[model samples]
Target: MEEAEDDLALLVWGQAEQRAAHGDPSFVRGLAAQLAGRHAAALEQARDYERQLAHVIRILALTPGRDSLTQLLRLLEDTPPAGTHPGLRTSFIASLLAEHQLVPDLVATVFDRREWEKLDELRACLFHELLLRGADTGTRGPLRDWTHVRPGWHPLAWLPAHRRDFEADARFPSRSVRGSASGVSSQLPATGRLDPPTPRPSQPSALRDVATVDVHETIVAAPQAGGWGACGAWVFLLDHALTPEQVPALLPTLPMACVAGLGPTDRFEVAARPMDEIWHLLFETASMGGSHTAGVHGAYGRLWAWRSMAGLSGAPADAGAAEVEQQARQSTWFHFEADAEWFHNDIGSDYGIAALSPDRRRIAVLAATDTD
Candidate 1:
């Protein structure tokens, strides 16, 4: 009974704070949670708050979807003290994390080591929460490996090639100075401008290599793309413009299918999870998994170490760290074919967490903006 009073007290205080300034969402959110816990007693207050929240939401509805998220973030920032409830602060910050598609500048604040450990998880957790609430990122493809079949020093050749159709939104182009933003063709949209689609490439390339790769969804990754462009680990950093020749000194050792192309602009997303999350994914996979495991291995070590070595420096790995990182990144090479419309949420997955516009039926590669 006493606990009920305490919870109600917290809710009242939170509700009061919410009224003072709709700016600090933390307080209101904290109150909402507290009220939810004391559902029977806090009925009146909860309804009042919900009505208020819904009302303000109407105002927010006026903004663009992504913009509304930004406004919420700004509202939180403007409130020096979001409120007394730590839960409230979590709720406010969480809104910003899930609502915005890819706010590079705002998210950069997450790296603030001093406050990072505390705020970092709120983002990941909330993303999943949003998913539970039916926030669909849109399916793109199956989570698996690509088999690379090629006779060359390039390691990426070992991975499988995505069928040209993998990019339904992309078109094949000859003499493309640079790949399109969607990475296949820029002049054409994904739906393929139907004037009797463009002719197949005259390059006479044998695409038999497309069969080697795959996906292993036995375990799961986060729902939305979080880091730079997905594949949100050091492999992302090593991506700073590697050459076809240089790809091997840093990539897989197996006989490759073929190396297509990788540039400096790639990205990925990963949790700042305890060193353990990395450890588990590295140490616990099935026997076929080259060097990655998932449970105890991750529990007892630091996962980022392997990425630093195998990724950035292109040096050989330490005793176990090297193998673990490599396998974790590469193990999912098993093929699980599906349509882009079904896997848009997992697009750029080879790289990291990305939210592809499943409805984006067209694509156009932007002209080179960086001459360097």
Candidate 2:
């Protein structure tokens, strides 16, 4: 039986490779379509195998000398804009870019045009991959073009100028904190004002350098695990619906939080942190479990012990600290440092939280307002 199973796997892999080469969309779409419903472990194993095949195809296609970057970019732009198999093609292009270390050019081009589109997040993830791989590489040349585009307001426009600030926030510590073997029940630090304002990062001079009086600066929320970490098990509250074009603006606000829409996660236990956040947001939408009104009575039910609400405000004095804590757990305010866009292109609606149910429908969001 073991031998039979191994033979079956090889047979399937061969067919997939054939389909991938023919620019068939079904094979890739099928994998992406299965992403949300399956158990986490199984899904990850499948993606790893798929990535291996993708890399093999990319390496084989590279020409000896003529600008490989140009070839890769043409491959990306050539993908069908709207279709069932678009992801497969786009992901194929993304994999090629990542494999060849073309991130700097990718980022520079995106901002140079301020071209926000359906795959902006994928590009952001690519930029993130570049960030992780190119830590030692200098930013002067790669990002120089990006700075001249918007100077301010464009997300990461200040990246060239504020390279250090971007670097400091993006770097997550590797030290692990004590938690469940699953890493699910780890206790996160309480969300409260950090005493002594997080020192403001040096602003770029407008005259001598590109600077926006509107530059946003805030201390990153305490590291999830403290050494170097990404956003985990946290809730985001938004006032309105988001669109694809708005994603880059929103991403900078979440400089520390890594989500499925932004990029992949390095953690072994999770496929991508954003997926978990989306699932919980979906669960919240379905259960309406996280919504609450102002005051003590609204703090009903047990909150997830591990997660912290960041922007919740306005509690009555008589409500005991425990009650306020409970309230926060339910409808804590989330403070976004900047405006946002729809996280991913697949999202269906803006009415409530932008997530899909187990069946892939739009999920609900907390109705509590800024004052609540």
Candidate 3:
């Protein structure tokens, strides 16, 4: 009998998914409410076993709500699922809470239930998802609060201090580039001439005396994970301040170690780009990793990119994103364009961005390609 009931629940879930896919939002919502009510009834009768719990989870994912989320978290705490990978379990729960816009509530519940100690995996996953979502939507109030109360190391602990850089509106005034295939032009001059403008007079004359520095020595550290695909950063110090036009000339001088798997730098067509485009790429890369995997590396990728740029620019370790943007604005920026096939063994999807520090003492280049 229980087998038949589980089968029926699965059938209902399939139908609900179909309804949702077919644009029948009203039907899906109505069915979700009905199922939630049944789940609530089961809870009141003290018969809310695993089967019912699974059924409601499916329904709530389709139509997430605060009450449903609280109930699910409480049930999981009371009767943890056996034989489930904690990362997978918590990642799914985090998605539901993020969808329901209940992240703050989840944080409060963690505090109320003292789940941080008992459910460390869930806590880490939830906080990381919050950071990814914050980057996506530019919402930081919850993140600010989380940092103050967050226990132990978090993937995005630097966010609160650097919040100003991630502000989508102010820092990225031009939405022209996001979500458009041609947002960033791939065209480069046939001669590869960058045609850089004269260095601004405001730049200090002292910058001319700075000595060349090794690219690797200036970066903080590369991300330890692989999902980011062919990632690397380099810093170039020069006797004269670096300019947008100077990037192509410096490309060949990059340590073979820096450009090895990325293919010859000559094949990459370069163009000047705004600061907004680079931030979009960083945020998008982070979002992609988190969406595809059940790890904290996505947030790490974003943080590492920011930190690398900060380190090269001589910004204080705790400098906000806005301050970094301010520094970048006074410097030169460029984007490198190439076909994914241009990379070795035809690993498609390549992106590269470089910036000269406002002081012109350093040029930081960050590049990555996605295998997926």
Query: Which lDDT tens digits does candidate 1 get at residues 67-128?
Result: 66546444444542333332243433343243433433333343233433333334433432
Which rank order by TM-score, best down to worst? Answer: 3, 2, 1
| C-alpha lDDT values of all predictions | 0.27, 0.30, 0.49
Give candidate 2's TM-score: 0.26
- Tell me the lDDT of candidate 2: 0.30
- Runs in model 1 deviating more than 4 A are 1-41, 47-325, 329-372
Better of 1 and 2 by lDDT: 2
lDDT ranking from best candidate downward: 3, 2, 1
Candidate 2 weakest lDDT stretch, 10 residues: 293-302
Write down the worst ten-residue block by lDDT for model 3: 171-180
User: Which scores greater on TM-score, model 2 or model 3?
Assistant: 3
Winner of 2 and 3 under lDDT: 3
Candidate closest to the true structure, highest TM-score: 3
**Candidate 2 C-alpha lDDT tens digits along 172-200:** 11211121111111211134212112232
Deviating ranges (above 4 Å) for candidate 3: 1-62, 75-92, 102-147, 152-155, 161-165, 169-226, 252-267, 290-302, 311-331, 339-348
